[model samples]
Target: MRVVLQRVSKASVTVDGAVVGEIGAGLLLLVGIGQEDEEKDLAWMADKVAGLRIFEDGDGKMNLSVEDVGGAVLSVSQFTLYGDCRKGRRPNFMAAARPEQASDLYDRFNALLRAKGLTVATGTFGAMMEVSLVNDGPVTLILDSPA
Candidate 1:
């Protein structure tokens, strides 16, 4: 699994001209699941994302996790993160998991975050969606499970 995390002041996702998920003062997660990923990947990614200290502390240091600041998460499925464009103009998505498998794991990842006592909002799985956000520090990070 791979994830792109962004600290945001506000964010929202819309599908079919309707807002489905939104948040304020939180992190936006774009997740990609590989066909070979297992529970261990999910566990590690979930733990890391929840405990990451990317937010600022009182002295303006990047020392607080999203949970520490009472923030939320806007999770979105992002299979394209696995797109491989090494040899051609058209990127190959062979590394991405099948939709059914990806959706199941995506839901599980969200559940794990919620279990950690953080507010979690999510974009519809397997949908054509529009996501908008105001990046707080424009802070962004990418994480991938161990190979």
Candidate 2:
């Protein structure tokens, strides 16, 4: 499993020129599921993201978790995170999970985030989505489950 986390002042997703999911003052999450990913991978990634202390605290230090700020989350399925571009000119997606497995894991991942007591918004799985966001501090991070 892999996830690209972007802290944003606001974020939204659009499909077919219609706005779908949106969030204010939160994180924009681009999630990817590997071929071997399972519930355990989902659990680990969700827990790590929930407790990540990237938000600033009272002293202006990055010590607050998203949960502490009561912020929301915009989770989008992005199998491209698993794209292997190390060799050829074209990226290879063989490491990405099939749509059926990926979609199931993606839904489970969002559910896990919601269970953490955060407001979770999501883009339609397998849809062609246009995502927009105002990146807070432009703070972004990548997470990957152990292989």
Clashes of each: 0, 0
lDDT per residue (tens digit) for residues 34-124 in model 1: 9999888998998999899999999999999999999999999999999999987999999999999999999999999999999999999
Clashing pairs in 2: none
Candidate 2: minimum summed lDDT over ten consecutive residues — where? 138-147
lDDT of 2 by residue, 27-144 (tens): 9999999999999999999998889999999999999989999999999999999999999799999999999999999999999999999999999999999999999998999999
Candidate 1, backbone clash total: 0
Model 1 scores a C-alpha lDDT of: 0.95
- C-alpha RMSD of candidate 2: 0.6
The all-Cα superposition gives candidate 1 an RMSD in Å to the true structure of 0.6
The C-alpha stretches of model 1 lying farther than 4 A from their native spots are none
| lDDT (0 to 1) per candidate | 0.95, 0.95
